[model samples]
Target: MACKERSKGDSRDGDDTWRNTSLAAAPASRELGKAWILKRLVHHAPAIFHSFDFPAFELGNAFEDINVQFTEHGYILVGRSQYEAAEGPAALAPTFAAFKDNLCSVLVVNGLEPVPHETVVESSKTATLHRMKTWRGEGVNLLCGAVMEPTRGILVAQQIADDDRWTYSATSTQRDRMLWFERVYLPCGRKCVARMLLVRRPTGVATSPCAPHWKPRRRGIAATPSSLHRNRLQRRGRDSREDGMLVRVRGKILLY
Candidate 1:
């Protein structure tokens, strides 16, 4: 889900790289089911969202369902998996809020006043494309397609990280840590900090688009050879010093 530059002549229409690459086309009925499934999944992560007191929400349940679909689909469509995996589910609220805030920051960085989140949330179809493009120019990689939802609105974004990894510096404060590379280093160096922002569209709408690839039955189930290969891949290079960190990062995150 790492963001990459779109090829030249790529239409900034709603159907640009973000939409074409991440979203799956489904009937209204299927979409409802998907939403239901997502809601159920988020409920599983109670500790992550502090849902214990808030009986209306279930953070873990939401994450579990989204993870399943993301793995099957090959990219995350909703929620912040990377942050959640690292900091737990409560991280989603701030991470998503930060994502929105950063979009406005990018606009300001590029010499424009920050657009209000509400305004952006209510942006016209064409304006949505413009905002997304603006974000891309600022080094944000949007990975999700435009998802029109009744409760949450439209969601469109990419998974992104700072491309210039070498310039990053450590900080004493957590907020400082998050903003150090993104705001101070990159901006001072006249570089863009990586980010992702999803576009929100009107609700109850369906449009014509090619459907996403379906997961085959065989691929869903684990086979002996595949399992063995996966185990080997998990354990491979553990003894080698250079490969230790590589294995740690990839291994800690359970894709399944």
Candidate 2:
């Protein structure tokens, strides 16, 4: 479960580790090739930016479809589609079935470099209300709507104001899920841009790589494997159990 080594042009961060998305859907082995994901945790992506900037991290060179997973307590990066530009039906991004029939989800993280962003407790609030009442394999109550950001990678978003009523309500944690906006900041950046967030394409995963793969090489992990993804879960795993997807510029992540 480790295949992150892109070269040919080389960007900078050499050995940008790779070994995620396991427990089945296997592949990778040219020495860990690249490009093989399976309906990442069922599915939950499709534009829905509402905010997070730079034209959504410039779609980090068209995502490139990725997958990652690390467990013991934390790690999950899953990004999808847009493969370097287009291939068919404009590469599936009409907001992928209207945010999976209006269940909405988007997550971004990183506040203190490897550890400190409130200890990455599944984005807090009792682990996002026990992952909105668990069971996303289809339904435990369909994750109403969310757009959580953990911190540090230049997520300015949230500038809605005509009178600002972008609320669909539901917040005791998971009342069929509809939180849409929850932010907590404190990261400037130099080496921990901790990128990832460009979303869309959810018919139950199998794609959306942690972005930043223009092929000139250099970015691995979300866009870095998403700008060098931040799905990093070391909070309690002691070493690294694996649970990641890799972010880019837009939004949407599913952790474990």
Candidate 3:
């Protein structure tokens, strides 16, 4: 019997169908603009600092309570709270003042960059799946979700919450993890967008110097100084054995 060919839409399982619908209902135009701007910025950022590692930064209290205000001249003001120990309000006053000064200094040096017109600003309370979709549209191709295992560390699986339904039904495969945000168009105005599934691997397996928790190993192979000398003598014995074999072969040839 011939195997039945599945229809394009039919191939989408329940989870995939959910993701497709959720992505379709999302604010695509806004995400498209944000994705374009982020792509440009990421391309220009130095290799050391260019990354999608928001999770790492998010863990810090400094990032948790950030506030941004746009000035009339288009400069954004970013502020954070100062960590202070109790000595009374008087003791905390200097700390607060210093934090304000630091905030101003940081804004002067780094916050002067112009905001892209299409950027979408959301709070930390925003749904992860929605953020994933938005980021994916912005040309961030990584997929993030929760998984359960024996031990949970910073690398535990992403959890799908009630507020977001897009990532809930998707499978734990690499192909399902990747999202494609960019579309190419021909002169005729027909557009094609590519989507790929990326297989997830344990982190820090590559040659890049930035692998987490890596340490250097000692160079060279030698049991000890004496053992090294002994191995050299053993190699010479093997060489003499080969030379004796060659001499016997020559004698045999002469006799023939």
Candidate 4:
């Protein structure tokens, strides 16, 4: 079963864009019935956010038997023939959940730090709106979304590159939506690199650890992302190395 964090919200169109979408093969966990099903749910944003300092906690392991719902882009995305989710979302949860949950701990992010395994996301009464699912080959950018209160641009966008690394980025949009981008990216057995661009409102700019600069976008202008100056090629390249690097910025680690 694919673990989905759904919250109450009015449905809206798909926030980001997806290309080369394909569902992944069911995991072996589903066949054995080892899945995390919803037990108790809170429809409101956790108060932890008001004072979250990268606090770590478990997402209740009281897996119960319930009618788990699988939704995409705010609605149920029915599978086409062979791509069907025969056992419902739970069956695919382990595969997608494993791939997504592992990203935070595996990758060394800048500016903001990812909670231990912040798999259970937090979205205003719209957590469900933040999720997205788009499979590009075996790589999946399963997690993406932000609150619509302080809008930005496109809500979500992900790409699994040929070089084994994956990039998942999102922007706040005008529309209030419930979106889930689920396309887990597997780095095989190689050391993988995941760079999550964390942001809150449109003006919620996180400094690229290397460059402590913040320039919010105006109208249609694009905010400049952190770059590696040619002079610091070898010196700055350590950010993407195996053991993570420290990013000096105080901000929320937005999902990617």
**Model 1 stretches astray by more than 4 angstroms:** 1-95, 100-154, 158-228, 236-256
Q: How do the predictions measure up, each by TM-score?
A: 0.22, 0.21, 0.17, 0.21
User: What lDDT score belongs to each candidate, Candidate 1 first?
Assistant: 0.25, 0.24, 0.23, 0.22
Candidate 1 lDDT score relative to the true structure: 0.25
**Candidates sorted by TM-score, best first:** 1, 2, 4, 3
**Residue 109 CA displacement from its true place in model 3, Å:** 41
- Ordered from best to worst lDDT, the candidate numbers read 1, 2, 3, 4
Number of the top lDDT candidate: 1
Instruction: Give per-residue CA lDDT, model 2, range 165-221, as digits (tens).
Output: 112112221111112221123234211112333332222222223223323211322
Model 4 residue 6 CA deviation in Å: 33
Kindly list the per-residue Cα lDDT of model 1 for residues 92-120, writing each as its tens digit.
34544444445434323222333334323
Model 4, residue 93: distance off in Å is 2.9
Residue 59 Cα positional deviation in candidate 1, in Å, after optimal superposition: 14
Per residue, candidate 4 scores C-alpha lDDT tens digits across 1-256 of: 1212222361311311222222222444321211110100111122211111111112211111111111121111111001112233233445434334443343232113333334333222221111222121112233332222111111232221211112333321211111222221222322211112222211122111111222222221113222322223234334443112212110111100
Cα-based RMSD of the predictions, in order?
18.3, 20.4, 27.0, 21.2
The predicted structure with the larger lDDT, 1 or 3, is 1
Ranked by TM-score, the better of candidates 1 and 3 is 1
- Stretches of model 2 off by over 4 angstroms after superposition: 1-51, 55-83, 90-95, 98-132, 135-233, 238-256
